[model samples]
Target chain A: MATVASNQRGTGSRLKTWWTILKISLEERFVYRGDFALGTLMRFLPIITQVFLWYAIFAASGKEKIEAYTANGVVAYYMLTMISRAFSSMPGLCSGIALQVRDGEIKKYLIQPIDLLGFLLLTRIAHKLCYYVIALIPFTFVFFLCRGFFENGWPEASVLCAYFLSLIMGFLLGFFMEASLGLVSFWFLEVTSLAFVYNLLNFFLSGHMFPLDLLPDWAAQFINLLPFQYLAYYPAAIFQGTIEPNQVWQGMALEACWLMAFIMIARIMLNRGIHRYSGFGG
Target chain B: MTGYRPSYLNVFLTFARNSLVRDMSFRANFILQCISTISWTVMNIGFYLIVFQYTDSIGKETGWGRNEFFVFLATTWIINSLVQTFFMPNAQQFSELIRSGNLDFALLKPIDTQFVISFPRVDWAALSNLFVGFTLLCYSLYQLTTKAENPLIIDWRSILMYPFYIGCGTVIMYSVMITLAATSVWLGRNQTLYNFWFYITNFSRYPMEIYKVGWGMALWVFFTFIIPVLLVVNIPARIMARPLNTMNSQMWQLAGFAILATVACLMISRRIFVRALKSYRSASS
Candidate 1:
């Protein structure tokens, strides 16, 4: 009974530390309030261009539905994509990690009581929370203006639940995948070009440019098999209720599996990287 | 003031040569950057290839068919590559200079401050995009001319206008970037420069006609008249490809607007940079 109580106390203290870290991160971001707001709002500008591009395409086609998407349906897909991207995107996460590794700043975490991965993940959580809080206003404004484009209106409650789940999984998967890449900095002195290459692949494969369904059958099939689809395409598809109710479970399972795989990869890389790490200049 | 002033062209050439030496010092990194940039362009092409599969034209009424659209894409790559090569590195480095008090050294130099800040470095890897874009433009033009339908007449006037328009586009983009960089003086870190840059120029990547409807009409007016980004790519691409049904008068008007926009943007950005410099207290201060 005493041991159980002690274990509970340890877990409680750890949670408190994480909470404090999150709060401090949030407050730090709050200092840059104007940047936060403007940055969030500016992200919507590209969506405006995308909407215009899609409108022109749909108007040209003169089809109510092409590739299982009405004009409104396509716009909704993009809007939902923006939302999913907000969740999945980790701006500067990889580069920050790589820099820390390269500059020997990773040594501080090793000597300190803090777990580097846990601390980084918590900070990211705080960052995302802060981002959504400030960004929710602009997001609401944009989505409200685009309300008419959602031809199906609000999706069913169950689909919304799955959509949210997929987004969360996507966030985790993206984080771990990039974290693994950052750990490669233990080997490569400069990961900037590699990171850029990674971003290029992520941008295309994650369906930021267009719906993956629009791709040729074999290409789409190949992309679907990759974990990249979960990052943007799958979650948007879920929000649009384009994924069948029966298939949603399978999709979520795949998302979870990808998340687990990435987590393992990140852990293994960090473990191996630490053994090879030699601290840089004093 | 000294009676003798250094020639700006000679100073610029020296900066360019020094940057080349610096880049080549890290040969593997240089090669990697080139590879990374080329891979991105190829991926972008693949994306458009997929999009074009769905529709015969971007806008059926506008006649920006696949080949014409490719010309526009290539033009974007070319102009963007030039801006990225000549100006983007310097603009990005401006913030770092501010943070590290390196701007003091730059200010101490005996030359035009803007010229010194704007041409200190060249991203040679980005030149690959120029080469790729030129090839793509040639191929797309070939396809357009061979078509049995109304083909673009390659006149000396348009041909001469194209490079001028491209130059104008580069100047306009550089102005926008420098203006953004200048904000670091007052804003301290100005980390959102790239984000804002991406947002502003996103309008330039597509045909300007797409921005002619509903809320997009507002963007068309704003980016065209206010910010003048729509003029950057459109004027050059339209002049070069002569996409079907676009009038020569419209082309001339756009060309005229682009030239005016370039001058206006440069003046405004220069004013902003000077104002921002006045506000600078130095990193120590």
Candidate 2:
């Protein structure tokens, strides 16, 4: 009975620690309200180019649909991609981790009782929450302006739930994937080039540039086999109702699997990296 | 007062040599960056190849057929490579200079501050894009010439005008970038400089003809008449690839406008830079 009481107390203190981290992170993000608002608005500006570019392509093709996507549908796909990317895109996470490792700042994680991954995860959650609070207005305005593109309107509640789930999983997957890459700085001191290469690959393979279905059947199949699609394409596709309700569940399951795999990989890398690390100089 | 003048050409050459040495110091990193850039270019080409499978041209009656569009793409790379190599690194560092209080040293320099700020770092890796652009341009031009369908006639005039307009494009872009960098002095830390640059330049990457309809027309007019980024790549690429007879008188007028705009932009940007310098408060203060 006494051991059980002690375990409960330990869990309570750990939760308190995470709460503090989240609060601090939220405060940090909120401090740059104007920059955040401007940055968020600037991100949507590229969609204008996308709209025109796709309109031209569709007009030139003289097709009602290209690869099962109408002109509106294609534009909608890109807009949805912006949503998924907002959740999944951890802009500086990789570089931040690499800098920490290189500067021996990871020493704090070792000395402290808090788990590094948990602390980072909570911080990212705070970041996303703060981002949504600032970006909600711009997002609503843009979506309203582009409502015509979303001809399908909204999916049923079940699919919407799955879509939200996939986005959450994508967030976890992105964090873990980038964390793993950054932890490679333990073995390879400079990861800037590697990070660049990863970003380039992610931009393409994740179907951010164009839909994966636009590729040849074999190429599409091959890319679909990879986990990068779950980061951006899968969630967007789920929202678009391109994946059937049954397939949506399957895709979510696959995303969850990928997220679990990445989490494991990140954990292993962190353990090994800490083993290799030496905290020298104050 | 003793009359003393520094040779601008000599100063530029020294800067270039120093940058080359610095780039060479990290040979592996430099080579990796070059390879990465080339790989991205290759992927972009691959993307367009897939797009062309669905359509014969980029737009209805726009005349940006596959070969013609490829020429335009190559021109973009060439212009972008020149800007990135000569100016982008320095422009990116402008805010850092302010933040670190290093602008005072730049102010102390005897050379023109803008020239010094713009030319101190040349990214040698970016020249690889120039190489790839030229190769693609040559290949696409050959394909257009050899094609049985209304082959492109490239004459001495085009050969002369293409490089001239490319230089004009580079200058216009440099002016825009330097003006943006100058904002760093007032903003204190213009972290959004690159994002803003990318947003503006994104308009220039595509064929300007695409923007001639509906709401896009407003953007077209704004970019073409006000900022004139639309004229940067469009005029040079059109001169090189688009048949002369098919070109409207408006395009030729726009070509003339591009040259004038380049000079105007440079003078205006220099004025802005000087004004921004006056507003600069050193970090020490």
Candidate 3:
């Protein structure tokens, strides 16, 4: 009985520690409110170019639907991609980890009681929360302006639930995958080029550039086997109602599986990296 | 000391040599960066190839057929690579120089401040993009001449004009970039400089014909007459790929305006840069 009570107390204190980290991270994010808002709005500017390009292409093709996507559907897909990317993108996370490892800042995490992965995950969550809060108006305005493009209109409640669930899984998957890549810095000492290559691949394969279905059938099948699609494409396709209902659940399960695998990979890398680390300066 | 003037050519050569040495010192990084850049270009080509599978041209009678569009893409890569290799790294560091008071040292030097600031760091790895662009351009030109329904006539006039327009495009882009960098002197930290650069340059990547309709017309007008980035690749690509007689009178006028815009952009950017320098409050102060 006494041991069970102590275990409960320990869990409570752990939650409190995470709460403090989350609060501080949120505070840091909100410090530059105006800049944050402007940055978010500026991100949407590229979509204008996209809309024109697709419009021109569809007009040239003289097709109501090319590759099973109408002009409106393609535009709507891109808009949804922005939302998915907002949840999954981890700017500077990889480089920041490399810097910490190289500069001996990782030593602090060793001495502290905090788990490095948990801390990073919490900080990222706070960042996303702050981004959504500040970017709510811009997002709403953009979506409202382009509402006509959404020919299918609002999705069913069950699909909507699955869409949101897939997005949450995507967030986790993106974090762990990037964290694993970052932890490679322990051995490499410099991962900038590697990170660049990874980002280039991610940008294309993740459907941030265009829909995966645009690729040849073989190429699409090959890329779909990889985890990159979960980053942006899967959630957007879910919202577009392109995937069947059962397939949506299957995709969610697959995404969850990838997330778990990446989590294990990150934890393993961190452990191995810590074992290899040696801080030089006193 | 005041009478001794160093030759600018010699100084530029020295900077180039020094930058090459620095780049070679990090040989692995240089190789990896080159690989990364080439991979990106390949992927970009692949994406466009997939897009073109569904259509004959980029727009309705826009004349940017597959080979013609590849010419445009290659031109973009060429101009972008030159600008990035020579100017981007230096311009990016302009704000840092102000913050660190390194601009004081630059000002104390006997050479032209702008020249020194712009040419000190040459990212040699970026030259890989130039190589890839040239290769693609050559292959696409071959395809146009031999395989297309109407074979392109490659004339000596176009052969000479292409490089000249590429030079003009590079200068105009550099002018825009340096002017943006100069604002860092006043803004103290222009962290959004690269983002703004990307957003502006993204428009130039596609053919300008896409912007001829609807609200896109507003953007076309703004970026063309006001900023004139639209002419950077469009004029050169059109000149190379399309027959001269087929070019509308408006295109000829725009081509003429490109040269004027190049000179005007250079002069205006120089003025803005000097004015911004005058406003600089160095870190020591």
Chain B: TM-scores of all predictions: 0.96, 0.98, 0.98
How much is the lDDT of residue B155 in candidate 1? 70
Ranking by DockQ: 3, 2, 1
Q: Which residue runs does candidate 3 get wrong by more than 4 Å?
A: A1-6, B1-3
Task: List model 2 lDDT by residue over A62-179, tens digit each.
Answer: 9999987999999999999988899899988889999999998999999988788888889999999999999998899889988999999998899889999899888889999998
Arrange candidates by lDDT, descending: 3, 2, 1
In Å, what is the interface RMSD of model 2? 0.8
Per-residue alpha-carbon lDDT of candidate 1 for residues A1-282, written as tens digits (9 for 90 to 100): 998998899798989988999999989877877767777777777777777888889888777787979877887888888888888888898999999998789999889868888999999998898888888888898889879999888888988888888989989898998898888899997888878888888889998778888988998889887888888899999888777989999878877888888899888888899999988667
Residues B98-211, candidate 2, lDDT per residue (tens digit)? 888899999998878888898888899999999999999999999999999788888788899999999999999999999999999988998889999999999999999889
In each prediction, how many residue pairs overlap at the backbone (N, C-alpha, C within less than 3 A)?
0, 0, 0
Task: DockQ winner between 1 and 2, please give it.
Answer: 2
- Model 2 chain A poorest ten-residue lDDT run: A247-256
Top-DockQ structure, candidate number = 3
DockQ for all models = 0.72, 0.80, 0.85
How many Å off is the CA of A117 in candidate 2?
0.8
